[model samples]
Target: MRLIQIINDIRLKRKLSLIFITVAVLPLLISGIYLTNKLREVMVSNAFEQASDNVERVQKRTAEVINVALDISYQLSNDNRMKSIASRSYDSYNEVIQTYRQYTDIRDYVRLYKEIKAIRLYASNPTMLNNWEFMQPDEQTTKEAWYVSALNKKGLAGWGYIQDERDQKHYLSLVRKINLDDLKNESVLVINVNSDLLNSILSQESFATMIVDDSNNIVAANRPDLYGKNLSAVHAESNMLWQSEGSFDAVMNGKNSKVVIANLNPQNSWNGLRIISIFTISDIVHDANAVIRISAFVVGGCLVIAVLLVYASASLITGRLLRLSKHMSQVGTLSWDSYLDLDGKDEIGQLSRQFNALVHRISQLMFEVEESNQQKQLLLQKQNDIKFKMLASQVNPHFLFNTLESIRMEAHLRGEEDLAQAVWQLSILIRNSLEVGSRQIPLSEELNMVRCYLELHKFRFEDRLQYKMEIDPATEGIEIPPLIIQPLVENSILHGLDRKEDPTLITVRTRLNDHGELFVEIQDDGAGIPPKKMKDLTMRLMDSEEPGNRIGLRNVNDRLQLTYGQGARLSIESEEGRGTCITFCIPKKGVEPVVFSDNR
Candidate 1:
């Protein structure tokens, strides 16, 4: 009940603002937030789908490569020539030559299959040449993991990745034990598959992909650095191989990533092979985040615009009521004929008409007095105009310029070159100050004035002041507002340099950017303005109504905006105890001179 009473006491405009926000802007904000969240979720889902597809593709290609290796191993195992050579015991040279010819046929098979790296046959027969294609089982060979595993498997083909003894190159080895009953001898045939073939299958995948064996050792990966490393070393979860198909979030190399694991063929000899795809989640959501940011900005902008429109509409509707209320307060002093010209059938309009009717009856008594007061107001306005013109004329630049010229002449006659130079600079300043006919002058003219002012200050400060002017020749012809650069330079000298004990250095620079825009900068190496003070100064520059000082920084800023648009406005950057820099840009195409009423 208390809240209701307070709301009733509030004005109609405030109630309207509340209604507009609740009915329009509130729903918009809610929907915008919902849509943004939904869009992010959709993007994440799409990324997961892409990762899943890549994993599936890698699984298919890896299965094909493994199947090729399996086919090569089966062919080598079933070859009659391989079995015959293992069963026979060569004695004559011609018999050994025939065995060599049969082994050459096996070599032809390795050459036919590009995936086959090399083929090795180890036998108990001492007559066989222990060369590239044949080897005698030594202690090192028997101790190897592949050799032991193959021997345990007996005649069944065993598959594992191992390094070649000759080149130290990795290869997928298919080892099978052969038992020859004719010679009562046993032999081993090893088929080495090129690891590059497996790498080529994974290379086409876009995401970071890897193939790991049953032992979790990485056989092939897109990044060479990860090859031969354990899968558990990259991702903490070593059980990822057990999962047939799934994705989970994990940290890889200290970065947030999504890992997708898919089993290759479960029935094949390479059943333990798993294709893992890992990608940064941030990379997937980057575009979505950009879209959300833009959407948020648009939503916020709409809300602000809605508030402004509501306020304006409410103010328009309530203005008549306020005017009627004011007239009621001054009813005793109002004339009878001074009626409100409001035309509406609304309650406020009816009240205004009624007030006009009541005032008409009281106006006859004060009509003569109102006429006399009107005449007095007209006379006061005329007096104000005369005073304004007189004040404008009193700002005489000619007197100051002539006095400086006289001083310059006297200094020259007395042979005081430095004094005469300072006097000449002061005269230039006075002459430029008097030229109020045009708002814009050549950038060269403005820079020349700044140079003259700084030179005069250099004379006054002596060794305590150092100045540098670096002006691009291309920017000299552009036109800008007069005194725009000078006041900033003056500000640096007065506020920036005054507090420092060491020598102060001021730099004035102008350059043409790639866009053909002229940028002017003024920097000082002195005690800089504080951050809080710099913020206050920036706010003051933005305020147009309050031109506090006659020749102040705000005055220059307002003039720059008036002559050129907001594009050409002053920007202040300062750090305490470091320095200050004031910069502004001017387009190559000059703007027309805008005549301001407050120029005088």
Candidate 2:
């Protein structure tokens, strides 16, 4: 009740503003917040579900690779030829090589299956020659962990990273004890699984995925650098892999990461492998953040519109009341038909007189303001014209001297026809330069001038200087200040030729950035600016004073800043003895469409 009484005491404008905010803004604000949060939750849930599916897919593929090794092991375990070769003792190396060649099943399996890289049988026969395929185990080989573990497992298969005697490169191999004549640790079959094939399976996965054995040695991984590395060596939060079958959040490689693990238990294997897939949280919900940003922008835009509408409505209501009050106070104050009206210096009468004086003063001010704006416009036009002329004067003398010297040198060396062509091109450049006074031309026309300049230089430099223009077709219709591109191109050629004997390449490229801003770059693969000079030049470009050395460059920078605000200024990137790239960007807001044109 007190709130209602207080509200009633306020003016009608305040009441309307409050009502507008309550009715239009409050509900929208509430719904927008609720929708944003729900959308984020749904996105996160969907990402989790998708990641789970990916893990399952990787598990199936990884199982197939593991099954190949198991199938080969099963087939070889029952083969009589392999059993006989391991059981028999060989007296001579020649006899052993002949016997190995005759028993081709192991070689055939390695050759037939893309999943199998190598197959070796370790026999305990003392007289057997140590052929690579059938190797006699030494004392150290018999005591190794893999060898001892396979012996203890009695014929059950195991997987591990074992060093191959041939290349000495460690590979994920299936190690199993082959029971020959009731001797458990007498013979064994070691089938090295194709590490390339295992890596290929994980390569198809989107996230960083790897296959780790029960021993925590990474057998194969999508990231090649992690192959054969222990789990603890790569990730600090490796303890999560001990859980071995679920998704968990941890820090991997110094980044917050989500890890999903699944076990691959083959048919009769002693130990199964683990499939671990890791992805950063940001990568999983990038699309969600984008959606949230768009939602916030929309909500903020609507709230701004609502506030504006409320202010406008309040101003309209209060203005009407003030006008009504003025008219009411005027009644009985003005008299007609030769009767003298006496006015009191009361509050209402004083307000009426003051209002009239304000009106007269506003009228006079409006007239003076209009006159001042016209003068400013005229002054701006004159300034632009003078600026263009100054920039042109600074460029022509240096350009003409160089161009004429080139033509004279060419005429001396070549035929008169070449000199005529050079002269015609020079005439065209002069005309274009003279006509470019404060007028914006299509980007295509400016690029055409740059091409002409490069062509003339090509005639002078021959193969010493080469240039290419990678111009975006969309930017062709954009209207930009004339002579902006050609001067920069000339600057590149001038510096690019100095202290360089190799073929110099001048690349003039133009494109639009993601924000629809126009970007232009002039690149030169030649001797670059030294760091000290580069620093001095950068500082000089920032000063308001005009530069004496790089006048054309400074002029172009000034004109771009003046026409399109300070965001459009030249940026220099250079490394001494390597190359230099000069780039500039014009903001999207600064690129205005021009309806009128004077070609001259």
Candidate 3:
């Protein structure tokens, strides 16, 4: 009752107090949420944009720098400097090698060769580029991917990696091809790039950036260590089987994260992928406590100051309020020292006016608070709207139902009209039961439709199947939600029936309370759900996966909880032969369009 009175009082004064309280409190709350979400998105977008721009810039710069090196290598490949060695002449090859060593080490030209590790030109098509090392005869092998692609590709290009004499890694290889028709074209002009530099081209600065292949496998990560791991894995629950696109909020190491991914084959190249995701932490757990503390401080401080004014300046209150009003004319620009402009002897009057002004400010804040609360409520409603739609679309039972209806219609025109119409009605009922797109549906509609489906199936098998439905008369007018009962009936039919020769019996019951809620119970007799399968199904429902999980029931459960807060749930109770029963406890609100006609 005290809480109710407080709420009533706030509502009464809501308009007056908005400016002072709600203006400050509500922005802080909303801004707190925006900071947690929007800021991370901004940071990630900026980071990737910078990364792509940097890579392009580096590639352009490298192209310019490497032109000189490629020209020199091309000139030498045909010149007497390299061709002398190509003819297996010791003196010529030795002179060329000495000339190479005098200038700089092998690492010097790597920054120029964007994709070559260590390249040596061959006089004729020698089997391997590595075999013609200048000084130290290292791990020179002709069988590398870069070596093969270089000789074959014949352009300004870079392949992946290969280790050198020092067993150091390198990622680029470049080879220039010659016309060879004019002069006795000796060797292929080759200039290999250093691999370490290639890796450094896109290293991590803050959050990691990774490149995924078509298979969802990470080909490269800014961290380098995660280069081969797959990001789509959830304890092997989801694998990167196909290309996926969108932004989703996920949990990473128990921290809230928003991940956005796009299949990027920029320049329309299918050779690689661009996969980007950003993570941000959210702790409303802490925000709630902060709000409580801040609210206490705000309300307590204002009340304390108000009490002080009443006790300290009773007689001069009206004059003080006027003086304060004059001072506030320059809210942001005024000087506090000149606040007491009154020439009267009533110092107490001046103080009283100022105190009253303070009270007025609090009143304005209260009004603003109400406005802010309304805005928050609106925002929540919008978010729930999307959530409801997502849940409804999750498990689409439309296709199966539509096919059933088609079968029924064909049967109806062929002299089995009663049975066909029954099938048609059952299909329509199932279709109606599949919609989870709303938070609240009318209880009347929910019950009537379930009755249609249950009756249809009940009549199909004649005396072989039986059903009992009970509803509390008082709960008839209450509002509930759509499609909350079908899953319970389904579980009973599929699991409880269990192919038993004994007749099948199912029961559905509903009850309600003054607090505005509905309780629905469904009981069936057949083979009961085992404790193990039941537990697994419950767990899977929380995190639905396709094919092996309870796709229908889990999807329904998710929709129920997400749409109607925590009040709705599905409960199952069954044992072998003395059949099974499932119950859906739903709220007495939001039920509507009680029955969907097959007309659509």
Candidate 4:
């Protein structure tokens, strides 16, 4: 289970490699095993059949040799020289010589037939020559198995093993008893068969061959060591000899073997001879084994090549998927200026093309969002400017200035010069305040308006109000929003000085800093606001949110910020019962010129 999980956790390329190997190699392995088994069976069967055929051929050859030997024995039994010798008709040496000459004819038969080793005549006649061609049976010769067996079955041919007197070599002899009643004597004819004939017949076979007699003794064999041995000792089972034809599997000579048994003419002799063939199983299946090895190599090589091809192809495909995954991971963090360049109609290529389109659409939507936001900011700034202008226009100074002019004229006509001057200052102050058409005006003109207003305030308060203006000459020509400074001064008089018991002093100062920023300050020596109230008003000025009750101060800050962005700002410093100083800084180059409509 752990191995399976590990395989599952493997990458797609490795997984595909495994799948390819299983698909390609599994059938090959099964087929190779099946073919090997079938080939082994077929090869072994063919070896058995071939061995059986070879044994049959050897059986036929041995039968032919036995038949030829039997025919020679029958011919010898009827020979006229042997009949004369059996009749004892030869008395003189001349007659014996003639008979001996005829006996030489039988000896010539042995030389003529290669299967016949020698032919010997064993007679009871006294006149027979005891030479190589003829033998007079002695006590030992007559006691021999072949001699005794032949004499018991008179005139009938029989077969047995014997050792030749001339070479002491073993041979299979065909023995027949010759009975001649006219001569009142008996003779035995022995035809010694050459063992090389049977050996040659068995030796021609490819496998080991043995000719076994009825006694289970091996009469002839391809392996000389097996000759004359009991056949049962070689193969534990002698039942194979009884099987006249066919094959079987058995263990022989410490090896697995196929045994084929055949008989050499069972009907011709009572003592049957069997031809047994033994072939080792390994030798029979040798070719099949070679074929199986070659097939295995070929199949293994094909599997390796197939796996390599699968790995390469799968890697190529999965590599594109991995690259696509990487690109998608970077979608929001980086610019989507480019896309995958895989150019094919495959699924991954299609996915890449679609991803590029998606990124392009996203970029376009983001651009639209940014453009919309910029337009909303501009619209908001315009609305705030319009609101500021409307707030400033709320106090109409034209009518008030005209009324002050009439008051000044009346004071002058009544001969009140001091009151008339005060009324004239009031008229000038009102005129300056009425000039609301210009969003910006020169600082000198605004300062003059401030002076007029202060003079009028001083005239009204008498000894209770005192004020001073310390303005820099360099800042006099600087453009500022109209009515900005006067509001701060008005706020100080209304909120701080109005409740003061002692005489109040208000100071208005303007200067340009080294960094080209204009600083304006309104200071009052009067009752200051509480710490909490001061903090609240400071927050109102600094906050960009809409003003609540402190509209005048917030309006001034808003107008500065709208025109000059964050570069222009208002800051207030105050201490309870000490004084209050409201200061604002405007960058010289930061302010934007404001355009005002004459309709206001």
> Model 3 misses residue 199 by how many Å?
4.6
**Can you write out model 3's per-residue Cα lDDT over 1-600, one digit (the tens) per residue?**
664333323422342354335444554565456454544554545544554444444444344434445555545544553444344434455555555565343445544445444555544433223334432222344454444554565443332323444444332333444434334442344454443443454463234445454545554556656654665662122422343655555556666555545554322122334455444444212323444555566556656655564444333344445656666664435233333443333434445456557656766787899999999999999999999999978755767876787788788779887788788777767666566565565666677787787778777667767888787876665555456676667778777665666788888887865655667778877667777876766776667563444437776776778767676766656554466666666665533224435892
lDDT by residue for model 2 (1-600), tens: 665345434655566667677758686877678766867666666667767888899889878887999998998888878788788767887887788778888888888999899999998887677667888888888888999998889889988888998998988889998877556536878999899988888888767888888878899998879888988777757455577798888876577777788888888778888888887755566547656776777777677777776676556445545764655465335411121121333333345566566555666777899999999999999999999999877856657757766776677567687666667677677678767777788888898888888888987988999888999877887899888988888877777775689989999998988999999999998888889988877877777785465547778899998999878988889888888899999899866544435774
Compared with the true structure, model 4 gives a TM-score of 0.42
Q: What are the runs in model 3 whose C-alpha is more than 4 Å off?
A: 1-80, 91-119, 122-140, 154-158, 165-168, 175-192, 195-201, 210-221, 227-600
Total clashing residue pairs per candidate?
1, 0, 56, 0
Q: Estimate candidate 3's alpha-carbon lDDT, on a 0 to 1 scale.
A: 0.54
Per-residue error for 257 in candidate 2, Å, reads 3.2
- Please provide, for model 1 over 29-110, each residue's C-alpha lDDT reduced to its tens digit, 9 standing for 90 to 100: 7768877677767677777888898888888877776666677667766777777776667787578776777577568867
RMSD of 3: 28.1
Error of 2 at 378 (Å): 45
Models 1 onward score TM values of: 0.41, 0.44, 0.29, 0.42
lDDT of each model, Cα atoms only? 0.75, 0.78, 0.54, 0.76
Give residue 227's error in model 1 in angstroms. Answer: 1.5
Better of 1 and 3 by TM-score: 1
Error of 2 at 591 (Å): 73
